[model samples]
Target: MTTPGEGWKTPELRAAEAQVDARFKQAQDLANRLRDTPLPPVPPVDFAAIARQVERAAQERDAPEQLKALKRKVDAGEFTWEDVVSGKAAQDPDVQAMQQENVNKMKQAFQMLREGMAADEIMAAQDPRRHRDDGDENPPDVFTEDKW
Candidate 1:
């Protein structure tokens, strides 16, 4: 290799320098485009509040009396967690009401779904509106009155 001072000013060095200059220009152009482009606004979220709520829920579940009481209630009755929360055992009326509301909502949804399905089946069978006429397709020979 040529000495450092002499090599720095040579045509090869100038070419290498030019290449570096071009790369720098390209990088600057990319940076400029990135700067000009608009980005979506960050979501407004309370991470601290979410963390505190999670911690509180964990503490409530881990509390000695609460866990013991919950277990005692479970042992005393044939009840799931939902029943414990909603069935006359919940100390807090608000929690009881919320759980009962949830149970009622689920029951209502299930009943509505059953009714809807029944109505759909009934409509499909009785109503001529949505019924389609069969083209030339016929039953297989196995379904016909034939010797087994």
Candidate 2:
């Protein structure tokens, strides 16, 4: 719509101006398309996963032989955490002796209990001298001369 001069233009000039205007409009359309179109999305980054990968790579680099040996054993089914076993545990003689003593005491107690049940007496009539049925409350202590 804007002209450079006030004078009337010839046919070729007008045609040339129209061609230039069309090309300018085409260029503007291309510019608009480029501005309006969306760009491709960028993928999300996983820093933690990257860090773990780096750590594993470093460990493998540092101990390649050990890792390979372990892998070989695993692949051949020669080793397993469940299959690992402990040797016979060492027993202390003192502890074994104590256990035997306790076992003997328990056996004696059970025998005494069985005898009491057969005789209808819960106790073996608790040694007569150890517990007296006398009505005396206080008994005199006969101390030695040194204790006195």
Candidate 3:
């Protein structure tokens, strides 16, 4: 090993430095060649035309599949054109039942509100924690003044 203050002029170091200098010269020559070469001009793109072509191709590919699905639904008696036009095709029986249940619950809630029941009373009545068995004749009064 060389001393800290010694110049780095050992034979091995000189050989390494020469190799690096040769590599640098080669890289510079490549850069010069690249700079001297002429590049081809880029043509302008028509994005709208490309988008239209893609949309047309997609429509062509998807049309038969969509028609087949519609035909299957019609054959199964699951849909009609009148249902589609009336926006009722989306509402199946399960969806209708759920909507009706919700409406009934809302009506009951409104009736309770009109009868001067507090919101907390309504919520407490609906709370799972307060659930009782059908055999229990009298459910506990959630609105009792002493409970609070």
Clash statistics: count for each candidate: 0, 0, 0
Model 3: worst 10 consecutive residues (lDDT sum): 57-66
Candidate 2 residues lying further than 4 Å off, grouped into runs, are 1-8, 41-148
Q: 8-119, model 1: which lDDT tens digit per residue?
A: 4878777887899999999999999999999999987655565455335435533334444444555556443444433444664443554566577567656766777565
User: In candidate 3, residue 120 scores what lDDT?
Assistant: 72
TM-score pick, better of 1 and 2: 1
Question: Per-residue alpha-carbon lDDT of model 2 for 25-133, expressed as tens digits?
Answer: 9999999999999999999765556545533533553333434443344346664312221111114332244346546756766787876653324233332232444
What do the candidate models score in CA lDDT, each in turn?
0.55, 0.50, 0.58
The digit string of per-residue lDDT tens for model 3 on 103-143 reads 77678778889999988777666553444544333335534
Cα deviation of 1 in candidate 2 (Å)?
5.4
Per-candidate TM-scores read 0.31, 0.25, 0.31
C-alpha displacement of 138 in model 1, angstroms?
63
Query: RMSD for each model, in Å, please?
Result: 20.4, 37.2, 25.9
